[model samples]
Target: MSRQVQINKIVGRLVAKKREAVSLTQEDVAGRLNLNTESYGRIERGVTPLTVSRLVKLATLFQCGIDELVLETSTGLTGQAQYIANMLDGVSSSDRDEIVKIVEKICALSHKKHLKSIKPY
Candidate 1:
């Protein structure tokens, strides 16, 4: 397949994931976006190209950015995140959540420290 086809597939999968995350059916999303159910299904299956306005509407409906919908999230993970995932392998979901919370706290503190060090540049 061409690069555009691959990208379309990624975007479709992301849109599907976002829709499912919000507990919306394809038909529900179609209604909200003023599309028919069949058209929406085609979009989710990567066979339909979304217009710019439709993409914007989808982003709004999903409470996410257009980039988030178009980008393949698994391919965008940071090296640190990959390492964390490796360490989290086989861990329980609750434990993984706790570990992520700790990491987030540390990252927030590091961000604050970095901000304080940027002296009016």
Candidate 2:
């Protein structure tokens, strides 16, 4: 696939995942975006190219940042990291710190659990 097509597919998957995360159906999102179900489905499937204005609207509707919708860096974070960054867009520094600490703790606990599940060599 072309680079743009790949990016579009990635963005579409991200949007679809976020929508599902918030318990929204494709029909529901279509209505919210003033699009027909077929057109919206195309967007979700990356058959249609997304415009900046539409992207901004999606970001607002999804409660995420535009960067999360568009930025894809090979050397930097993408996917869930981008989503988390978007979520932190308007958060205060202290709140961000607290969230980071909580995430770290969760990761540590998950790592411990994973280690426990491993059989000895």
Candidate 3:
């Protein structure tokens, strides 16, 4: 796949995962985003390209940044996330929930640490 396509897939997986983490079904996310299930499904599948506006709405809804939603990676998502998402595919639903929590925590801490390292002090 092209890098863009891979990025899209990674973004889609993260969107799907965040939605699930919040106990929001695809239909729920679609409804909240003022999109039909099919349209939202396409977004989640990386079949439809995202507009900046819609991406903002998704980031707001997911309580994340636009970059976090679209950049792809645990860091930016990218192809790396696709492999990780695929590995996560085999985890049972309950275990997956725990894993997601851990991943989110790690991401948050890593982001904080990164910001700290960038300080000129």
RMSD of each: 11.3, 5.3, 12.7
lDDT of 3 at 78: 65
Candidate 2 residue pairs that clash = none
Where in model 2 is the C-alpha error above 4 Å?
Answer: 72-121
lDDT of 3 by residue, 1-121 (tens): 8887887777788788877877789888899888899999988898887788888888888776566576545455466776576577668999999998999999999999999889685
lDDT of 2 by residue, 17-86 (tens): 7788878899998998899999999988888988888898888888766765666534545567766776
User: Model 1 lDDT vs. the true structure?
Assistant: 0.84
| Model 2 global lDDT (CA atoms, 0 to 1) | 0.83
User: What would the TM-scores of all predictions be?
Assistant: 0.63, 0.64, 0.56
Which candidate's TM-score is highest? 2
Clashing pairs in 3: 72-76, 72-77, 72-78, 73-76, 73-77, 73-78
Q: RMSD of model 2, in Å?
A: 5.3
Q: lDDT of all the models against the reference?
A: 0.84, 0.83, 0.80
lDDT of 2 at 114: 100
